[model samples]
Target: METAVASAASTGRAQTSRSRCRMSPKRYEAKLRLAEAFVRLVEAMPAERITVNMIAEASGKHRKTFYYHFADKEQLVVWLFRYDLASGLADKFPEDLLVREQDSPDNPLAEFPFYARRIEESGRIYNAPFFAALSYSLEKRRAYYRRIFSTRGPGTLDFYLHQLFFPAIKEDILFLIDREIGRQSAVERKALRERMTSNAGVDFLAEFYTGAFLSRFVERLNYTSARRTARDIIPFENVVHDSLAALIRQEIEKAAREPGSEDRPGKGGAPCASPA
Candidate 1:
């Protein structure tokens, strides 16, 4: 009896391990199909109009398969926004453009146009469908975000913004500031850090960048036209680069003035420091 029980336990463990396997190619492809289907449907109809059955049919998978993979439609929507869209952008955009190399002397923001030009030139990269989906999340989908922002939904608007739109922009901006201040004497660096991390300091950096740079960028990109999109690339790039640089300079200047309040960053690399 003891020997039989041991064998059965081993078999059960093996089955559990197999079920928990990391996403294989087949699994990833299925998820991608679902995400693409959701994106397509979202463009044609409001999110509230979309149904799980529609998504499953569009992806050519059964509704049960979707349930097996995702808990519900909301879960699927979050995954599409958080992982699928972010991953696609990361794959297409140059990751190195967002960070400063120790030896490079050029402005970090200067690299924005270089990559922006790539997306503009590639017919398929920032094409109509792609731009529609991206801009809608930032623009048309404001109502959905506002709802979650006001109350506790599965995720937060702040997170959706960070993961979807602000990842590279936030990283580069913070890195530029870090390098600039890092050269200062230890005393100045410490003082600046504290000032930037304080309450008054927090509002200056966070509100300016998110409200100014990010918000304006999305608003400008909301329009969809091939001719206008090409024309807007350089201007949009300038807006992004200039706004971030301006924000950094403003914060640095403020830090210089205020000895009491300094800025530390947030857990997810947001400009705002967490409240004490």
Candidate 2:
């Protein structure tokens, strides 16, 4: 009896491990499709106005399928933004950035084999996880990030951030911000221990810009949704980018002039601190 129980327990653990494996190609494609669909829906309507049923319809997937992948709509928002920051969307696609750029696109080659991109050339992005990630074909690549850059409509980071402040997803945004700040604090603490140049200013700068952009964005959304006379909030995007960059440069220099901030950096690498 004891021997039989041990064998069963070992078999169950093996099955559990296999079930948790995220390396499957199927899961990757499915998740990408769902994410793409969510981007489309949120672009046309505020995130708070979207529903699981709507997302399912947009994705052409069954309602139950969504639950199998995520607990709720809020999970999808968090997952998308987390993926955005992690995948270097904020860095690679900064044309839509509301304030300033701080990061860059992650290199897919770092994880995949050298031939991984070649495998993607089978003329179908969905052929492999690597192609969806590493393909240079902009049209084909749209499956992953085509919608991320429009400040006006689709994949606009402004829309993404603007919707977060709405009541519908307030808790979700709070959870994400808390987690991000926690991660930043951990990184800063780790850098302090190692005596390295810490990116301590990143979190503060991100907070400053996010707060600034959202305040204006909230007014835009409110005015539009109410059918009021609309003035474009960010008519000239390059101008906004340049203006914000200059403002930060001014402020950082001003801060450094303060008595205790002599050691603080007056400017960062790149106009936005990409470090290269």
Candidate 3:
């Protein structure tokens, strides 16, 4: 009788442990689906318009199940921003040299096209709701930076990382739009030409308009001039093709090196999916 009782207790403990192990993967997968669905939904509409029911319906999960995983919509948005956006940014900045490369004058604006393509691809897979969610997430990120570093000196590393670098990337996109699409319009073309040709106008415009748009943050961050090396300027098309090809090769190598469904905890205990 004593041996049977001990055996039963051991079996129960093993079963409980196995059950928990099984549940962890299920929960992780559910969260992944939720994040993907949320991105789709936001692309279609603004984050404010998204509700628990919408997420549940899009993910094909019940509202109760979503509530079980996330406390509310705000929490879900926070998780997605911290895990998805931050991780993507980290992946792009794989090396310190990559950061410097971004600031190099010779580097073509091909990266912006890659991001635009990513957005379009996500839209096709999900919905407009995802883009709307991303916009709100970006706004929140900006507000967070403003609150944290509003009064502090601008020359800090934190200031550059949180304030200047990220916003500069966004501004670069706007710059590309001005150069490409905005120039095509006759009214904009004439105004831009007038503004550029005026005495000290280009510098003034760069300072006020281009620089001023992010002056609040840029004023605080340390500005370092890129090294005066003879950097090669690859054509935008070639750069895109090469960079993407390299990325694919790297991914293949990474998969061969690490092949398993290991639960790697990302920012905020979120499971980080391996690159496909």
Could you say which candidate leads in lDDT? 1
lDDT tens readout by residue for model 1, 183-240: 5666667656544443444334544554454344344533443323324454443454
Q: Lowest summed-lDDT stretch of 10 residues in model 1?
A: 12-21
Clashes of each: 10, 0, 19
What is the C-alpha local distance difference test score of each model?
A: 0.44, 0.37, 0.37
TM-score of every model versus the real structure: 0.51, 0.30, 0.27
lDDT of 3 by residue, 90-143 (tens): 343222212111222322111211121122321211112222332333444443
Which residue ranges in model 2 land beyond 4 Å of their true spot?
Answer: 1-64, 77-202, 225-236, 251-276
- The collision pairs in model 1 are 194-262, 195-261, 195-262, 195-263, 196-262, 196-263, 197-262, 197-263, 197-264, 198-262
The local lDDT score (0 to 100) that residue 200 gets in candidate 1 is 49
Q: For candidate 1, what is the total of clashing residue pairs?
A: 10
Candidate achieving higher TM-score, 2 or 3: 2
Worst 10 residues of 3 by lDDT: 12-21
Comparing 1 and 3 on TM-score, the stronger one: 1
lDDT for predicted candidate 3 compared with the true structure: 0.37
RMSD (CA, Å), each prediction: 14.0, 16.7, 24.8
